[model samples]
Structures are given as structure tokens and as C-alpha cells.
Target: MAVVFENDLDRDGRKRATASLMSQFQHAAGLCTIIGSFTFLFALVIGLIR
Candidate 1:
């Protein structure tokens, strides 16, 4: 019983860590996508003006 309880706790900790890491990565990817799109639009506008 004690071993099972410890295993459960360890599993929970690992799951929480994985969730947080995934969220951080998702946030960074979103920021990069937004920046990339903005830059693309800016370049397009400049090209049209010229």
C-alpha cells in the first residue's frame, strides 16, 4: 500500500511538470507566430508602396 501511494505521488508530480513545460512552449510559439506575421505584413506593405 505504501509503495502504491508513493508511485501515485510521483506520477502526479511528473504530470504537473509536463503540463507546465508544454504550456510554456505553447506560449513561446504563439508569440513567435504573431511576430512573424506582423513582420510579413510590414514587408508586404513596404513592397507595395515602392
Candidate 2:
């Protein structure tokens, strides 16, 4: 109970932080691409119907 705050400036933590950030960025990018494709397809279908 004496050591509640671990050191935050460690090598492993920094490496993990960067890796996590990169993966999260990629995830968001992929989601955006999927949504964009879906929206485009919906618009295309609607246009064709009209």
C-alpha cells in the first residue's frame, strides 16, 4: 500500500502506447472507409432507382 503510483516513464509503456495509438488510428480509418463505401453504394442504388 505504500507504492500506489508506478513509474509512468518506462520503455515498455511508451512502446505499448505508440502501438496502441497506431492500431486505434488504423481501426478508425477502416471504419471510415467502410462507412464511406456503404454510403456511396446506397446513393448509387437510389440514383439508379430514380
Candidate 3:
């Protein structure tokens, strides 16, 4: 148990942390892209209708 904990504390934990960071970054980027696209489309429609 201690060995497993130590391994996680050293290398494995770092990998997990990096993976989580990357996943969060991707999620944020996706959200931004979706929101930006929607806003752009909405503005375009509003402009055209006006």
C-alpha cells in the first residue's frame, strides 16, 4: 500500500495531474468555441433581420 501511494505521489500522480489538466483545457476550449459560434450566428441573424 505504501509503495503504491509513493508511486502515485511521484510519477503516476504527475501523469494523472497532467491528464486532468489537459482534459480540463480541452473542455474549456470546446465550451469557448461553441459559445463563440453561437454568439456569432445569433449576431449575424440579428443583423440580417434588422
**RMSD after CA superposition, every candidate:** 11.4, 9.8, 9.4
Off by over 4 Å in 3: 1-15
Q: What are the per-residue Cα lDDT tens digits for candidate 1 across 1-50? A: 01111222254455455555666677778889999999999999999999
Provide backbone clash counts, one per model: 0, 0, 0
The 10-residue segment of model 1 with minimum total lDDT is: 1-10
> Tens-digit lDDT track for model 2 on 1-50?
12222234455555456555666677778889999999999999999999
Tens-digit lDDT track of model 3 for 8-44: 2344545466555666677778889999999999999
Per-prediction TM-score: 0.67, 0.68, 0.69
Give candidate 3's whole-model lDDT.
0.67
Residue 24 miss distance in model 2 (angstroms): 0.3
| Top-down lDDT ranking | 2, 3, 1
Stretches of model 2 off by over 4 angstroms after superposition = 1-15
What's the CA error at residue 47 for candidate 1, in Å? Answer: 0.6
- Please report, in order, the local distance difference test score of every candidate based on alpha carbons: 0.66, 0.69, 0.67
Give me the candidate number with maximum lDDT. 2
Candidates 1 and 3, the one with greater lDDT: 3
Poorest 10 consecutive residues of model 3 by lDDT? 1-10
